[model samples]
Target chain A: MSDPIEFYYDLSSPYGYIGAHLIEDVAARHEREVLWKPFMLGAVFKEEGTQPLVFYPKKGAYARHDMARTARLHGLPLNFPEKFPQLTVNAARIILWAGHQDQAERKRLSLAFYHGIFGEGHDISDKAVIRNICETHGIDWAEAEAAMADPAIKDQLKEETQAALDRGVFGAPYFIVGDEPFWGVDHLPQLEKWLESGGW
Target chain B: MSDPIEFYYDLSSPYGYIGAHLIEDVAARHEREVLWKPFMLGAVFKEEGTQPLVFYPKKGAYARHDMARTARLHGLPLNFPEKFPQLTVNAARIILWAGHQDQAERKRLSLAFYHGIFGEGHDISDKAVIRNICETHGIDWAEAEAAMADPAIKDQLKEETQAALDRGVFGAPYFIVGDEPFWGVDHLPQLEKWLESGGW
Candidate 1:
């Protein structure tokens, strides 16, 4: 057994959601566990002095179209959220809190959150929405709500984001296997090859 | 035959260089011809208020690594240019002129320029280097040199770039099949699937 594949993602990133759907399967194939680290991509973007990929001029429109097309090609359902790129800091806090309790079950909550926000076009930034997802996933809403504001959980996310920056993670769906880093969902195939061949 | 697949690229893009190696084979698989359109990506970058993928801080370093890794994964040779993102305006203009003379042979020249810059780490912005590649390919260097400076040939490059912008081409190695547009070397698979299924 080797170190778990580090999977970094942002809830607001559609590509992140798309990658989330498949990364586990790829990791499972190699008899490896995956550590899902959800961070605030907004903070990374602010630090990098760049915006979301879908906010550029001509590139934005093309990106939106490409997102839908990519989702379709992969047989995943995606509907663009009306309130896109919603503030996901609290959502990060929730995931961090859950993972602290049960590392194995946290992925289900993350998937539920991603599916709600991207797969169903729900607003993840809303607390009610987050609570609904948490409770639906068997997480106690009262405890999870309290944990969302827990200073330790908040610091966990902040420190995680800082560590991600230190690791040169500028985008969502960024993966780190061993010392090698792979960015974007598009690099999934290469990531699999690295796992199989142990780097080329 | 349907309309030829539009293949737009910049001389300095490594991904564009990698894409050039495989697009012809993919297009040929579908019995389609490729129209190689060379344009100044720097001009498009200025318009979009963005720079090359490898110009950003953290993203830049990762992109360089990814480019090398991706090329090796595809079994193609790649060595980073000494002077990257070189003044490729003249290289683009030369291609436009050569393509005007012979559309098919222009791709051969484009590959030659890409091989010199990325495959062998040569400085491609120099007129001597361009002339060497031109002469090696049996192209009339003197006429090509004169054509590079000709105002009409220059305008042809400008018009081609403007047309690319109008078509929403914001990056290198962009492809269009029918009314559908696909971006990046990663999307080549999806592009091929589109070609196979007509549409999905």
Candidate 2:
């Protein structure tokens, strides 16, 4: 692989979780390394002036149907998180710390956070739950928690979030390769095709 | 055809222009009546808290590129309008008036306006330009202009726009067959397929 694909995601987003697995498969197939960049979705939304829902009153219903259809189409088991719109600051911080330590560990924890919320309905906002996820991934919970509390790590996450906004990213689960940003998980195949075409 | 497939459009939108041509082709193939609905995009945006460009500075560039790609994929000629984000109040009013007079004439004018703005780089905001478009479509400009200025016609346009927003329409060039709103022009094939399946 010449350059690794940068996968920007947040743990709270269902589509981000979906793309996490799908991107792994695509990256493995193409022998491309995915540089997972977990960032603050709230910050991105604030900077971009994007509402949480596309349609206000009807968004919940539409989202449910859209997610169901997407899950069915992708053959993935998906259910709405009980504690939806949860705070993902710690999750992003841990992923950033994990990335600094080991690439595989970062990818493992990213999926764990996703599964914790989206798959198992666990409230990832709880530090204890996040600690459990860290321990399960064979990462030191104390160190992960310590790193998350570090102001430097929080600043790094903030910087990355601003960078994403500056790069024309309006939504979550943006995949960037060769300075070309693909906004949504739905555009993954197009991203893969772009990758195969020698990084457009 | 049980009921005519409602084709909702705003003249200032490039995608609406592109869709105008494609809808005609689909209607001809499926043997359905295409009801041209000319409604103000600005009014819809105001009611729905939607900005023409999603309230992000960079989105405009991404949208332009994405629209170009979509147009290319559909084999349609498209040029981004110079006075992009042009006012469509008059254009929409004329479309509503033309719809009342003749559906075919409305469709023709819709295409003409789309072509004039996106294809030929003409100033769609000009009253004379709109009058010329009406005349070119075999609509009497004086009567069409008069109808456009009628308060009742303006009220009807607002009603149509409000109805579209109530029906979960957030963007331009929306199509509705029954209760299903096929959002973008790209969904036309799927809409046709749905129609062919006898409304299952």
Candidate 3:
């Protein structure tokens, strides 16, 4: 069997939310599991010597329009959280922690986080929001909260971010299929085609 | 008649080359004309405070791969020029000059320039290469050379670039259908849908 599609994303990325919404179905069609790996996009940006899409005024405004338009195109709900590009360290930590326990639950927790941020404009960076999402997902809030404070989990995110950089993941919604890297949610069509044809 | 689909691009942009190749057909399917406008992407980059895709180490490598992969996906030939992101001022000037004469010829000359740069890896920044392309396209080489040197034409390119900035064009392969702006060749699907549905 082919390896699972390694999906790398950040909690603060709108495209990442859209990707999380769509990747599973795409994976299912090709009979592949998705490994949801969340890392700090801020770390990637700092290393790449770039800023978030909102840093550039023109690109930022276009990105906001594009984000909503893209979400509409994909039939997904998107509402910008009051604090955009919020600190996602803890959110990422919880996801990594969830993955340590169960991969499926990790995907679930990640999607719930995405829906909260983009679908409902909830600040997932808040621990209360995180705690509430944990409750909704049947994940133990106490363990999840503890994991967020765990040094090992914190280090794990840093390691995963470094690993992502080593693998040339410089953007959110980045996917690795058998060592082939595809970036951006827009490339999902090409990603699917690659899976269907194996390589073209 | 419906307004022409305003296509803003740069000769140095690979995605712009691909968009130039595919946009005419997409326009024809929906019965629209194309207005090919070449501007200085370097100017846009400066104002936006962003570097070209190749400036970042990791994204640069991924872009090289993605450009080739995207070209293949579109079934278009792509060979990187000896000097990529080359000074495209003169190339843009010649295109703008051609537009002053005939829009069709302008598009033809623009495609010829794009094919010369990306298809055959020619250094388009060279005036000799420019002269050769002009001659092959049945354009008067002497007149084309004069246009490239004309201060008015040089200023026209600047004005066009500034106008692009005013219109929120921060990247190549940017399209404006009516007042709606779409960036990137990948967004052509959405652009077409917009043209088909007016707005969605």
Candidate 4:
């Protein structure tokens, strides 16, 4: 079997919410596995010396419009939580935990986190909201919360972020196939094409 | 006739080079007119409190890769100069001058500037290079130079830059179709769909 596509994203990213839904289906068509990896986009930002999209001057306004418009064009739901671009360190810990469970559970938890922030506009950072997601999805809330605090997992996420930096990932919804990297949700079509063909 | 699709670009932008070619063709297919407008991206950058794509650490590297990848995928040639993200003020001046002429002439100059920078990797900020392009294209060099330096023309470019800010244009290859704005060359697909369907 071919190597699984490395799919990296921050759960708080609106584009990542969309890509979380996209990469799996694209992979499925080509009979490929996706290794879903969640990391802190903020950490990536700090390394890259950049700010969040909505914090910029002109790009900020355009990002808000593009976010909704792109969502509408794709027929995706977006409520855009009031605490947008919320500090997603806590949410990412749970997603990393879920990734260890299994592929199906990983996708479920990832999508639930996305939907919480973008689809339903819920504060995903809140432990209660995360707990609700865990309860509804049949995950062990106690273990999940406990795992979040595990120094090992916290260190793992930090290490994962460093690995992402090493691999040149600076944005959410970043995909890696072999040494090639694709960033943003917009490149999914190109990604699918790359998969369909050996490469152009 | 419907309003011309306001095509905004910075001549220094590789994506803008691609967009310069793409927007016109897309507009022609939709039977729409394209208003080729050149503005100072530096001015926009100042207002946006941002830097160019190639200056953002990891994003800088990713951007260099993506720029080439995207160009190749779309079958556009890129002869990126050692000096990219060039001071495009001179090239933009020529473009604005051409825009004041017939549409064909505007496109000719725009593509010439794009080809000179991204296609040929010539240092377009230099007067000699601009002179070469003008000579090859039968443009009046002395007058074009005069236009570039004209205080009124310089003010006009400034006004256009401010106008773009007013319209919420934040980046190169920004498109305004009706009241809706689309930023980035990747959003071209959505822009074409919008033209085809009237709206989403």
Choose the strongest candidate by DockQ. Answer: 3
Clashes per model (N, Cα, C within 3 A): 0, 0, 0, 0
What docking class should model 3 receive?
high
lDDT of each: 0.89, 0.77, 0.90, 0.85
Please tell me how candidate 2 rates in CAPRI terms: acceptable
Which rank order by DockQ, best down to worst? 3, 4, 1, 2
- What is the alpha-carbon lDDT of model 1 when measured against the actual structure? 0.89
Q: What would the TM-score be for candidate 2 when compared with the true structure?
A: 0.84
Per-residue lDDT of candidate 1, residues B1-200 (tens digit): 97678999998999999999989999999999998989889889899888988778999999999999999988999989878778888878888877786768779989999998999988888988988888898889889889889999999999999999999999998998777898889889888999999877
The residue pairs in collision within model 4 are none
DockQ of each: 0.80, 0.30, 0.83, 0.82
Write out the backbone clash pairs for model 3.
Answer: none
Q: Which residue pairs collide in model 2, if any? A: none
Strongest candidate by lDDT: 3
What is candidate 2's lDDT per residue for B99-156, written digit by digit as tens?
6779987877777888888877788888988888877778788888888789998898
Error of 1 at A83 (Å): 0.4
| Model 3 C-alpha lDDT per residue in residues A17-96, reported as the tens digit of each score | 99999999999999998988888899999999998998789999999999999899888999899998888899889888
Clash pairs, model 1 backbone: none
Q: 3 or 4: which has the higher TM-score?
A: 3
Docking class of 4: high
